[model samples]
Target: MCREPYPGRVTAPVFVLTPETVEPAGAAATAVAGDRLVLTGPEAHHAVAVRRLHPGERVDLVDGAGLRLVCEVTETAADGGRRERLAVRVVERVEEPQAGLQLVLVQALAKGGRDEQAVETATEVGADLVVPWMADRCVSVWRGVKAARGRQRWGAAAREAAKQARRARIPEVAELLTTAELAGWVRRVNDAGGLVLVLHEEATVPIGGVALPDTASSEAIDHPADEPRGGGKGPQDPVTIAVVVGPEGGISAAEVGALEQAGARTVRLGPHVLRTASAGPVALAVLAQRVGLWG
Candidate 1:
């Protein structure tokens, strides 16, 4: 006979949701409804076998889309010879959107496995996008199957971390890029409404001093005496921001020059030297704070 709720007995509910199931529904719009959600794939397995959740039992269901659903298990199917099924009925749902500052971390690939840590931290800190930059100083080489596997692993980490943080949007992990490729990406993102900021200790200006180009500035209307004049629409829309970080050995002078030539403004995080893996997320958190993302 079991004594009344044995001392130190495990009571906190174990999750049935895993990275595989969570990733698909994480960003999908149709995966969840108000106070109701459906679980499939590995999530279904965890619910049935690992947790042994039964009908009428309450549980929390979090979709990586920033919706947290408090639900009750309404049906359960568990048999030794057959697959299991678990159904949940949502009791409540909460939705929280990402902050106004759409920060993207263009992180240089680092030696060892630090890139993964960077990805995980960026996801937790609410980075809207993570681009793996293969700078000249980057020591870890990624190609073909290794690159694919690494990306999958990073995606899984991001999904799990997003769920843990209860974020509404899953940050994207872009395919790896070389220095030249990264510059082109910067140009594309700039055209898409982002201001490019490259983090370099050599920069004299702090990020706080860098503001979006004001539409009303006289420069918007005045034609430079040295340039050919052409009619144009009003000042370009507010540029979105992309923050770039360097590798373990830090960015080279030539690479920095390239980024600057590509229209990226260099800014410093502070006086202390932060590892390549730490700088991107630190900058992101600062940007998030500046834009009132932190509650």
Candidate 2:
């Protein structure tokens, strides 16, 4: 039996809408108050046709952009025995504080279906960003239509996983990057006042021992030409850390060289080897906890 309290019956169906759809001036004029935010979409279909949700029920809705709402259904539409519109009254709307640490996982594409698992776990564990790295050892080749499909699949998985974990924020999945492009990204992030940490099985230092780069030091660092003009300050200053995880066969010597050249610090996670799919999230969990984002 589960020891945790049951969240209670969901009265309103929760759905994710584009930022434009959730804006006050947009399609649905649902008011926000406390912890409740209200909106309706295909998620309504899932609630009615799938879950058979009815009026007076409650459900949690998130914009996947760090907004969460708890709402109660006030009205439901029936069209030829099929559910259509769902109107809900917002009971509460709460904005979660940003995680102290912004961890971006630059994961090397892996063979098989491991890449999807990596993205799903990364989102659930609180990664702020996910970047697909096309490393030298990557066995998975994403091109043309496959690339488009992969991006869609990854984004959908992240959204679904975020809801499952009850997270207010959903991480962004960046377009795929080649080794050279990834190095440039590392440089750009570092120049933008973020610290980049590359996970290497052969590294001697434990990840826990790694401290966020001091704000003062980050400000003193030079910014790359393409980096944003502002030095680390406010939300941007406190050590933006990127965790780079290699593929199943691991990062190549050249790839490691490129990262190091881009000023990424190599850190080890643990004694044993973790699968390509697990390393990124496990590292993220540790970082999130150290930074007080997780208990």
Query: In every candidate, how many clashes are there?
Result: 7, 15
Evaluated against the true structure, the overall lDDT of model 2 is 0.70
* Candidate 2 RMSD to the real structure: 6.2
| Deviation (Å) of 288 in candidate 1 | 0.5
C-alpha displacement of 237 in model 1, angstroms? Answer: 11
Candidate 1 local lDDT, residue 256 = 88
RMSD of each: 11.1, 6.2
In candidate 2, what are the lDDT values of residues 87-137, reduced to their tens digit?
666777654444334668888888787988999999888776788888888
lDDT (C-alpha) at residue 204 in model 2 = 90
lDDT score of model 1? Answer: 0.64
Q: What alpha-carbon RMSD in Å does predicted model 1 have with respect to the real structure?
A: 11.1
